[model samples]
Target: MPHLTSPAPTTAERIRSACARAGGALLAVEGDDPVAVPVHHLLSDGSFAVAVPLDRVSTASHGMAGSQALLELTDYAPLPVREPVRSLVWVRGVLHSIPPSELTETLDAIATENPNPALLQVETPRSTPTNDDETRYTLLRLDIASVVVTDSTGAEPVPAADLLAARPDPFCDVEATLLWHLTTAHNDIVARLVSRLPASLRRGQVHPLGLDRYGLRFRVEGNDGDHDVRLPFHKPVDDMIALRQAIRVLMGCPFLNGLRARR
Candidate 1:
């Protein structure tokens, strides 16, 4: 795999897509004794909304309204692998608790995006104090000030304005399904795709790791080590049909002569 030296503007958009697709994020509160908690989150625009349990809320230094905090979200290969991490995104921001008057609206937005059952418990009533934990779920909005993205390439700071304006990749939500199908249902194509890799990388088992409008990413596992390679498309695609056409073109010219070297 080649290392990315020059920063790509799309890095911020990729980070946002990862946050949206991630099951949850490790939220680290900045303070004397920092606390890290895993909470389901929804990313929209430049902000993040996470559903935190009331019991664990206080532990988060900035769990209340008008506080500052940091959040870390990671994207990993859908399949098990020696090196699963694909990318990491760190967000620094101010935290603000959702007011009682806005709880319903917040929950509705979360459900609309994530459709997680835990979000529905926010409105359910319970009889016992222990079961009353339902009301304990609170939504905290993180007003993002800055975003940093790190991956095989390196760490790159993303301007808040660019991060806010960039949208996730067109296939962000269904990349997993597409990759799984490519790896399982189309072994012949996978083998042809692997042929495009450098001789040193051809020894390992090749599997689809990710896909986006720009290109496809593959994971190679061998005795030496695990490596990831990104194969760019002839042009950026916008829909499934175009994406399929790009894949066909990629497979047709496995060597991808004259194209930008993988990085």
Candidate 2:
């Protein structure tokens, strides 16, 4: 029997991508008593930083300034499935609060690399604020010691340097929107794609599961069990134009309905 596999993004790439689109994440601050800190986080290069509002900081402030913590960031399948977690990343590190004096400079550097809406709360108000309480934020950074990523393929360790250097997938930001659009607006095209599966699995309810730079993954809900199928592209695509062409190829015809096959 032959084995099957689909090409996937590297572990570092997956980790970086997950951080970029973090939705449900948990920050566990470890000590004699482990504390779960609510955080709004940002990732710059390899730096994993989070902003904690002072009002809520007291909960985990006992040993939080310099504590061992693990940040778990998970990526779910764009479309809902029995198990929606598509990928998971664990970052183990020591937490360090950014000194007040350097907060402005640090935020500027982070914003340049990756501008996120989460930074709004901690941002220095444009005009001097009357009440300092309104803008009190304790900026914290996780000095990453090690990182591990897990997905359908398996688990793998990522080096700090590799995570820093790795570039996120070009399609990372728009993947969810694209998949949702495909299912809602152009389901006829989705049905066409599902036809590539084996006859046994064709009868199952089809759900758009995952989309990456390399291929598309679909989940088939059936009587016996659920099945996941991958429609691999001949080559990796990094942009929308190439993705459209790749998808067309996967739809079983490289050309349009009216067009004749190339000789």
Candidate 3:
């Protein structure tokens, strides 16, 4: 835990570098069982700093001296051709002693990219809802122990055992995606739409799409519209995979599942 006195000229560059380098780093911290978190944190003072978690953390280590831990970083880029699902890694770097500012900014980026996040408005049987209640902050503080970088083309095995130690606690968006298909078709379409898209045109929450009692709805920012996709002779193929799965279940019970009139 060292802090910088003055701002560094390359501070911004280093912050970006720290984020890029930490993509797959192994975060090691002394805990009851030695917690290992991902290293995709950012550096602010052009170096490493203590990361604050959104959830409850053990403050025992607060006054204790900081220790160093090793990390592994990975960056994936798609191959020139599209036929085979392949990618090329362009840049790779290792970091040490990352700054606190960088870490905070990095967490913000990850939070923004969170997939299927739970809305703050929804209430369930689980707990009481209140305006004061907010999303927990999942933070990753880094003190770069040592780092090694390589391209996907390289065959050598980069030892990142310490990196893979802790299970990545699912972020907000991730939780949403996991619980997405629980009772709605909205998530299915969103995930599929995002997955099938290229990086150039990939938009997450840019366009909010959902399903209602009637059918699906699509809108940008403040403008949205709902339309019945099902039609005679031609049907909306918007979500064929889900449609097919439902069809299979329906076919299993040819009686239309009690819809037929008994003679």
Best by TM-score: 2
Candidate numbers sorted by TM-score from highest down = 2, 1, 3
lDDT of 3 by residue, 1-263 (tens): 11112222122222233334233333334442233233244333323322323243435344223444333333221111212211121122322332454443454454564311332222222335545556332343444433343322233222233233322222212223322452255554445433333343332232323221112222222123211111111122224354443332323434433457678
Superposition TM-score, candidate 3 onto the true structure: 0.26
Worst 10 residues of 1 by lDDT: 1-10
* Candidate 2 residue 32 C-alpha distance from true site, Å: 8.9
Error of 1 at 17 (Å): 1.4
Question: What tens-digit string does per-residue lDDT give for candidate 2 at 162-232?
Answer: 98778778988898999989989999989888777667656678888878897888887888767777777
- 1-263 in candidate 1: lDDT tens per residue? 32222232287688768876777677666563434333445455557777666666766554456767778888887866778888888888888876777667766776776787666545333313446424455567888888898887788888777766777788888888888887789988888776766786667877788888888777888788777777777678899888877777777745433365579
Model-by-model lDDT, in order?
Answer: 0.71, 0.73, 0.31
Write down the TM-score of every candidate. Answer: 0.78, 0.81, 0.26
Q: How high is the lDDT of residue 144 in model 1?
A: 82
Candidate 1 Cα misplacement greater than 4 A, ranges: 1-9, 31-45, 58-63, 123-136, 200-203, 222-224, 253-263
